[model samples]
Target chain A: MNRKSKDGKILLLQGNEALAEGALAAGCRFFAGYPITPASEIAEHMAMKLPAMGGTFIQMEDEIASMGAVIGASLAGVKAMTATSGPGFSLMQENIGFACMTETPCVVVDVMRGGPSTGLPTLASQGDVMQARWGTHGDHPIIVLAVSSVRDCFEIAVFAFNLSEKYRVPVIILSDEVVAHTRETFVPPSPDEIEIFNRVTPTVPPEWYIPYEDTGAGVPAMAAFGDGYRHHVTGLTHDERGFPSQRSDEIDALMRRFFRKITQGFHEIQRVETFMMDDAEIAVIAYGSVARSSRRAVIDARERGVKAGLLQLVTLFPFPRRHVEKVLQQCRAVLVPELNIGQMSREVKRVHRNSSRVETLNRLDGRLITPREIGDCLIKMYY
Target chain B: MAEGMTGLVHKYLRHDKKFPHIWCPGCGNGIVLGSLIRAIDRLGLDKNKVALVSGIGCSGRMTTYADFNTLHTPHGRALTFATGLKLSREDLTVIVIMGDGDATAIGGNHYIHAARRNVDMTAIIVNNQVYGMTGGQYSPTTPYGAMTTTTPYGMVEHAFDISALAVAAEASYVARCTVYHAALLDQLIESAIRRKGFSSVEVLSNCHIQFGRRNRMASPVKMLEWFKENAVRMHATSKMKPEELQGKFIIGVLADSERPSYNDEYEKVREKARGISVEPKPPARFEG
Candidate 1:
């Protein structure tokens, strides 16, 4: 896996393969995942690669176990991750919520495939946009990134681990089947070139260390399981001492900190790639692989003497509301094309004051929305 | 590290913040916890080098009360987490605590797989024969024909021999002891903790508040008395017929063997992976 060449050569690899390399570069020493379509390659790569790098990769019995194990490894002070698709993602929700409640830093990669159940195991879809945000129960904070390119599959993975450590929360790297299995060439970033944020450790004595004590950053310093600063971690609503508390004040305080940690940093957390949007009457908002279709559609609309631009979302959660509102203000109509029936459209409408100004172009036939379909929708809405 | 068993209890238990243990008054979790504390102390295990994981149940609450790297996860996923924790940092001693229902029902698949892999951790399953935290539901280990909230009349489900299951799953060490047998429970737990491969010790504990009351053995004392009368040692089970052993609780070292644990085998994989010769596969498929 550490096939670092002295010549700085670019390695041709699939999106999932690049992810394994990226995680290893970011100091990930653990991977636990159950095999599933679109995401299975990531585990296969990890199984073949991790051990060679002195890391551990375990293909657990199921997705539930896989998610639980990754969180456990993260608590043991290793950068850990688990990769899965539709069915596996549903199974992983329980422990993802537990990781959220426990404030353990880990990464979960959901390679998007079409589905409500196991609808399409190998086809691309962004149907899980809402699930990625609210899949876990309760009002817990999460950071989810949608990567559209093979390069992003590598870079954002390193970024996912960084965000997870910085916020002390599970950061999801969402990849569509197209992006996951697609092969491309990219120069792997050197360890020194990529900025990695490791979870901060407490300077105080073991007796004084409160595992869940929120500092000025809102993210608490974490002590690993074997760090000698032995402390408790639990999914139960816990006090600052990290012990379960039924006291209303304790529960309130913990939940407030969890949400505030990410919500307050919305400006830094939200990332959107805008194309040709400086002056346009029509705006198209899309994410994941659909963004590629939307981009081409925007270009075609421009050539056809119609003013159009693209709002390609890279960060999906805490849904770039301000950016969405800004784009809507400049444009008369917004076209949101997704693989599912209007999951992100609702989010867009929620942010835009005039919900009627936004239109959803959905495709659920186990196929991707084409450039022509998006172009047609933009014209129908704005022209 | 120098503390005796009693001193370790004071040292390890979170006295300031965690008080008033959450278990019911008549529950045997206290004895179970006490035995565990003593076992860890006697084994001279590093308190800092241990990570305790537990699932949702009365037993799940134990991790929060212990002064170690503790995780309280969803019901039945403790062993999965423990496996991950141990695999990541092989130096740390990971222990998982779960109730009978949590271990044998919802978490059954993970439990069997962990033992099958021979994961290097000690699983301390507190079997009270019923789901205590969520009220009285019949667990997989609930004695056949016992009344529970879920099993209104008599339990229609068969009892599971979890220790025997672990042994069959190839756990390096498998043992069981009742709360009435406090000294034996502690000893068995200590031995399990000190063992290398995947080891388990089922702590047959009293849950008078849940599993009793309906079965006509409501008091905690009556539960203990039943355990004292019914528990059979390992050797006696060999002499008894299936019919004769129907009402008995086998409590002893049921299985013990030597095998390379999961972690041990993984290290060999890592050793073999280093600078291995690579040979690309021959192309067979038409498409690139």
Candidate 2:
């Protein structure tokens, strides 16, 4: 298909719809998923657009199969993705870990809704903020990005795919119900301006190729099916040759490297948008929909003579700890507004434990914690 | 047979290793693995284009032994992992190898859905009737009234007829075989791998060390003999109902239908997308 122009004309589309369009533009050719509340629109959009764009889409029976198909398709050398919310995301955990261990490049979009089980399927919640990092039963580094606006959803979707391909690891876009369902004007970048990442493939012949041999980029060049690479890929503690091993030192090295590669590159993956933090004494830390509320609260607080600013997190995982620590050093106190009962608040507190006073404004009634509520909390905290 | 075909088969057959496989001596999983390797050799598939995915189980270990693009995933989630691999790389021949417990119990949901979607992937379930890896625990495929370590008396639950379930779920290809009939099992697996869309071959294997010893089906020879005596061809059983074929086990292809596979349907979409213009649409206000 011909590339679309980046004109300023407004087209009304849902958050999920924008994400699908962005993914298509990013060259995602394979989509597999099972429909779930608040996130089904992403699948619906893909179901319509993928086939028409020379891409593939399959409605899997459940979240587990959805994840499996994406992984399998990725191995066959396609840019693949899947979308889910809450319970479905929970079911995808183990395989998510497998994607991590095997270093497979793929994108997983979680449209967050209130949840412990099926708590509130149609409501917004940041409860999964921490779960996105620790849900899988292993110690592995992860890259998670949160979208606070409809425009950010499209931009972040493309970025998520880029990071997944660049790092050769699963990258997650954490979109809550508020952002997922919300519609906004998004001027997509011109085709030439759009950045894309393709996984590094092996240059050697199949016989000499070792799937897991790190090529100094902290990522091994991959060889998908039809590339004539007869190498094995597994979740087991594999040796450099990709064969399962039982040796303790080998296991330790593999696990250490898996964590080290992403952890070491934290600066590259960490992203945040600071608003008026340069001269503020009090900061409101937030992400996703809560960030939207905090932005307005910060603006009102500033006008009302309160030195309140916003530290909006765009990349959730790796927690942006370094930036939080630096901000805490200058600020007297920080207010965290989240949809869940203090999920990201705990992270903020943990990171800036004794450096600053961290207070939380939490809501879990399946409603967006309004800017007025956050503004009131800022006033009470500062006064 | 043609010289080229024979050479291709010889290339995949792991001949350097002798009869003593890595599996436990009485493990029926080895038989299932044997049948799979033989199937790949017989079909003459390009080793480079074939990928094997497995979950955590005694049978899950099959990927490590086989020479192919093997992926050993987490417990009870092999199908999910394989689904991703297959969808991303349509050119690769994807196969899911799991135990009865892995496929029908822990991973049961994935099985039905994969079949329902008719994805172009092969699911090889090695049904040993028990969870061999975690001691002899009863599995979903464990026959009713069968003795297990967990079920000291007999299993109270009825076994899932996986073949029937797959057929009902709209799987395009479905078949059943036992380790006893090596040649037939090989043929079934080979054909399933070659089939266009979601195909499943349930290999009723033996966990001689666990299930067999508990149920007095201990000897490997006896297990093979039981399969020979019990399993009847689908053609032979068609004339009879469930009552007439009461004690006999039915084997061979149970379902084979033509349907538009996922890849085929997806291609049509891609073609349409290609023909469309890329004129950017105007951005609009997003409302919740």
Best by TM-score: 1
True contacts kept of each: 0.74, 0.79
Q: Give the TM-score of candidate 2.
A: 0.92
Across A1-383, the per-residue lDDT of candidate 2 in tens digits comes to 11333344455667898888888878898888888999998888887777765667888777877887788778778899999999999988877888888888889999999889988988888888778898888788789999988778888888888888888889989998989988775566777778887888889877788788755667788888667886667777787777777788878877877777787678778999999999989999999888988999899988899999899999988789988887888888899888888888887888775877898988888899888898888888888
Candidate 2 positional error at A218, Å: 2.4
Report per-candidate TM-score of chain A alone: 0.96, 0.97
Q: Write the per-residue lDDT of candidate 1 for residues A1-383, one digit (tens) a residue.
A: 33343355556788888887788788898999988898988888888878878999998999999999998898888999999998899999999999999898999999989888988988998888788999999999999999888888888898888889989888988898998877886766666688888989888998898888977778888888898888878888888988778899889988999989998788778889999999888899998889988999999988987799999998998789889889988888999998898988898888887733888898888788999999988878776
DockQ of each: 0.56, 0.53
**iRMS (Å) per candidate:** 4.0, 4.2
Give the per-residue Cα lDDT of candidate 2 at B28: 74
Top candidate, metric lDDT: 1
- C-alpha lDDT of residue B99 in model 1: 89
Output the lDDT of residue A201, model 1.
84
